[model samples]
Every structure is written in C-alpha cells, then in structure tokens.
Target: MADLVSELRQRASALGFDAFGIAAAEARPDLSEKLQAALAAGWHGDMDWMAETADRRASPVALWPEARSVIMIGVNYGPDSDPMAALARRSSGNISVYARNRDYHDIIKGRLKELAGLLSRRTGEAVKVFVDTAPVMEKPLAQAAGLGWQGKHTVLVSRQFGSWLFLGAIFTSAQLPASEPMAESCGSCRRCLDVCPTDAFPAPFQLDARRCLAYLNIEHKGPIPAEFRKAMGNRIYGCDDCLAVCPWNKFASETREAKLFAREDLREPPLSVLLALDDAGFRALFSGSPIKRIGHGRFLRNVLIAAGNSGDRALLEAVEARLEDEDALVRGAAVWAFAQLADGERVRRSAEAHAAGERDAEVRAEWAAVLPEVV
Candidate 1:
C-alpha cells in the first residue's frame, strides 16, 4: 500500500500536477473552534454562505466520515505575460490572469476526477473528487496533505510552484499513506503584506475578504465602496496586486496549459470597449471565462469605477450613458463614477436629469448627491 502511494505521486506529477500529497481524512482538532471564533468576529463580511453551513465546513469528519484519506493536488497556472504591466495602461481594463481563459474550476476539477478514477481502478476503492466546490477547507486540507503551507496572505505557497498554483482534492476510503506537513517558510518576509494596495490582509494568514479586490470585483454583488475606488486603479475585473508582488513568484514559469495563458484580446482590453458591453454582449464576450459569472451589471459597474479613475474625459460619455441602465446597481455605480469624473457643468445636467426621471430611490439619492458641492 505504501509503495502504491509512491506510484500515485509519481503518476500525478507526470500528469502535470506540480505537487501532490495525502492526508488522513478527519477534521483538525482546533479547526472548528478557530472557525467559530473567526465567524463570531464577523470576518466573513457579506458572505452569508460561509455562515449558513458552518458545521460541515469546519470539519472534514462532519462532511463525509466514510473518507479515510484525502489526495491533494496543485496545478501551476502561472501567466506568460507580466501581471503588473497593465496597471500603467489606464485605458485597458485589467482582467486577472486566472480568469483570462477557461474557468479553473472546470480545468482542475476534471483533472482531479481523472486522478481519482485512476486510484479507484488500481486500489479497487470508491473515490469522490472535489475542487473548491465542497465544504472542505482546501487550503488547510492541502497544508495537512504536505502540498504547501498557508502563507501570510491566506494562500497556499509552495517552495516549487510558489503562490501561482490552483488546488484540488480527492477523497477515498482507501488508506493511503499521508505525507508529513510542510513547515511555514515565510518567516520575516512581509512582501505580500507590504504589496497590497488596499491592505486587504488584516493579519498574517488572515484575509478581510471585504477589502480584497478579488471580492469587491468578483464576489461582491452591489456598489463598490467609495474609499477603495481610486486605490483600485485600472483593475476592472479582479486585482492581482498582492499575488504579483510576492518575491517567491520569481520562480514561477509560464503556464504549460494553453487555457491558463492570457488571451491577447483580454490582456489589456480598452476600457471604452468594455464599458460598451450590454448584458447579452457581455455574455458573448466572456462566454468561457470566469468573468462571465459576475454578470453584466456588476462587471460594468467595475468598468465605470475604472473609467472614473482613468482621468480621461474620453470615457465620460460611456459612463453617462449607463445612468439610464435598467439595473439600479449599474445606474448607481454610474452615478458614483460620473461624480468622480464630475466637472462643473456635467454634474449639474446629470443631477437635473436623474432627479427628475430616476424612479429607484437608491439611485435617485445617489443622483441628488452628485451635486458639485456634495461631490
């Protein structure tokens, strides 16, 4: 059984998984208590889903007790292009590299299932595959499996793959040998913490998802906070400021997976063109990409914020045009963006137009607030 486990690791590596490990399929003794504390402190913010199923998420045993071992895997999805270059081009809306191609959930989940199927055939055991879709805490599970230690930024950091890797896991009833846990190597290194534009990391190994640009741009459903707007810069879809500035990523290679590489069109798409996308147009453009999940309203809301920060009067027309959007979320964000780009006269006309015609109370209030004195 031990030798067979060795073969599994080798096969996984050959199949392009950068790292592999197995862990005993049980909850950490302290995980539940720590999670309860984190939740009580309101660390999850607006993410009600995490709080809804607190029992199942805090413990692997509570999730599926029949599982005897968890096989963890990581695939490197390092981008071929420079993640930082797009920041200088204010006209281009910066899409995060992980979202540039086919969604990673689809990519890594398929690979994890294939590996699980192979293990089932060899060991004659039942196996279940998971890739961040389950209640399993993937980072902690990966850490237990010896894949990597969780770094200060709350992401799995590997000595080999660095922080530029996607994680997946497989659970099996077979008793596979578990690997020794990796020790934390980020001692005295504050590169990730120092690099954050919004200071999203409140403490080591803990993240305030509310302040995270990934959360604001992707997970967030409504208006972006006024404070973080200017700080957001040209990052329209998701922010990579923390991940790109990590010194450890100097070791990362260009991804071998063609789908993981940045699309030429998406790399630094013109903000004007992105602002032009209506719901149906947005759907067609981001069809296979992860950005599609955010829907047109939230996405265009982000683009409006970017246009406001652009300081380019050229994009003001597009920003003004969205004030009449059917979605109040879109209209309110447009109100905010126009306020940012608000001039002496443009603010007056917009406020007059919306104050008279705007039906949504929230949007009307936002329009009335756009007066130059208030703006």
Candidate 2:
C-alpha cells in the first residue's frame, strides 16, 4: 500500500499536480456538523445546491458506499503579477486571478481521470474521479489527506503553494495508507480578514458568502445588492484581497502551467470595453474561460456596478448606451452607473428620457431611486 501511494504521487507530479496525498475515506467525521452549521446560518447565500447536496458532501462513503480511500491532488495556479495592485486602475476591470485564464475544471478533470485509471489498473479497484463540480468537500478532504491545512480564510493553504491550489480527487475501493494531516500554521496573521473589501469573514475560518464580492460578482445572478456596490470598486469578476494578502504566498512560486497564466486582454480589462460588450462580444471575448458561464446580462450587471464605483466620467457614454439594453438586469444596473458619472442635469435628462418608457419595474425603480438622490 505504501509503495502504491508513492507510485501514485510520482504519477500525479508528472501530470502537473503540485501536491498529492492519500487518506482513508472515513478520516474526517466532523465534516457533517460543520456543513450543517454553515447552512443553518444561511452563510451560503443563494447557492442552494450546497444545501441540496449536504448529505452526499459530508461523507465520501455516503456518496459512494464502497469507497475506502481518497487521493487528493492539487495544481498550483500562482500568479506572476500582483493581483491587488490592479485595483488602482479603476477605469479597468480587476478580474480575480483564477478566472483570468482557462477554467480549472476543464484542466484538472482529465488529469484526475488519468491518475484514477492508473490506480484502477494497478489494484483492480473501482475508481471515481472529481474536480470542483462534485459534492465532495475537497478542502477538508485535502487537509485530511495532508495536502495542506485549511487556513483562517477557509481556503486550503499549502507550505508549497499557499492559497493558489486547484484541487481534484479520486475515490477508490482500495484502502491506501493515509498521510498525516498538517496542522494550521497561521499564527497571529489577520491580513486575509482585514483586507476583505466586503468584511465577508464573520469570524476566523468562517465566511458569509452573501457579503463576499467573489460570490456577488460570480455566483450571484440577479442585480447586486445596493450595500456592496461601492465596495465592489473596479473588480468586475471576482475579488482576491483575502487570498492575495496571505503571508503564506511568499513561499509560492509562479505556476508552471502556462495555460493557467492570465491572458493579456483579461489582466485588467478597461471598464469602457467591458461596458460595451454585447452578448456576441462577451461570448467571443470569454470563449473558453470560466467568465463565460455567467452569461452577458449578469456579466454586464457586474461591469456596471464596477463602473458606478469607478467615478470615471469618461465611461458615461458607454453607461448611457445600456440604458435601453434588452436585459432588464443590465438596464437597471446601467441606470445606477449613470447616476454615479453624470451631474444632476444630465441625470435628470436621462431619467426623463428613459424612466417613463422603461417597461421593467426594476429598471423604473432604479431611475426613481437615483433621481431624488442625484437629480
């Protein structure tokens, strides 16, 4: 079993996985309680699937009765440039590092399958593979497998990779020797918590997704909540403050995977370019990237929120162009952004022109609310 684990780690490394470990499937019995506590607090926000899949997620055995051991693999996706510095360019959109390149799911899943096939061929054991798409709680499982411990921000932190790992897992019927779990190394560091623009962390190791900009910009589908708009700043896609501030990252090197590196155009896309994106343009720009999943309307909604926060009057024309957009979600966001850039006279004129003709109640409500405050 020890030899098998060693062989598997070598294969995983060759396949571009930076970390590897094996754990008995039943190692962590505390997952169910932790998951229930978060769900009861409604910290998950609109991600109802977390609640729906709670049972299967809490235990590997629950999801697969025959599972005896789990193999956890991680690929380091460290950025070469400073992500937080990009915030100063308010006229441009600050995309989170993870989404600037290819979707990790597409990259990690195939590698997981190849490694799983090896374990099956060697031991004649049944195997199942998963990336982030599965109900499997990869973080806790990764910790139990000794890939790394969960940091204060609840993201896995490796001594080798910091918070830049993309996790994958393989469940097998063979009972492999388990690796020793690493202890949490974070001592007095509060950098991650203090740096959050939205105060997403309720406590150490706890996150309220509703207040997280990453959740608001990515997972969220409807209009962004009014409270978080200003905090959103120029970050149109996701927020990296919590992860980028971690002291552990000092040990992490830039990723060897060229596919995971940020594309030049997406590194800090101009707000003007983003605001002008139509559905076809959005599709073409984000073609194989994870940003495409949100669809153009939600993408524009996020862009407008960032535009409102930018305070760049130069974006006023692009913002006005979306006032009569096909998607009510986009039109509503455009109205809010228009108020931020235009003076009272222009705000009043635009409101008068669009407010009466606005068919969507939400869009009309946006015009009505901004009128008294600005006009």
Q: Report how far off residue 341 is in candidate 1 (Å).
A: 2.5
TM-score of each: 0.95, 0.97
Shift of residue 181 alpha carbon in model 2, Å: 0.5
Q: What is the per-residue lDDT of model 1 for residues 209-248, given as tens digits with 9 covering 90 to 100?
A: 8888888888888788877888888898888777777777
Model 1 spans > 4 angstroms off: 254-259, 372-375
Write down the lDDT of every candidate, Cα atoms only: 0.82, 0.90
- Clash count for candidate 2 is 0
Model 2, span 1-375: residue lDDT tens: 778878988999889889999888999999999999999999999999999999999999999999999999998888988899999989999998999888889988998999999999999999999998879999999999998989889999999888988999999999898989888889989899999988999999999999999999899988898889999998889898988999998888655562267899999999999888788999999998999999999999999988988989999999999998989999999999999989989989998888888888888888888985432
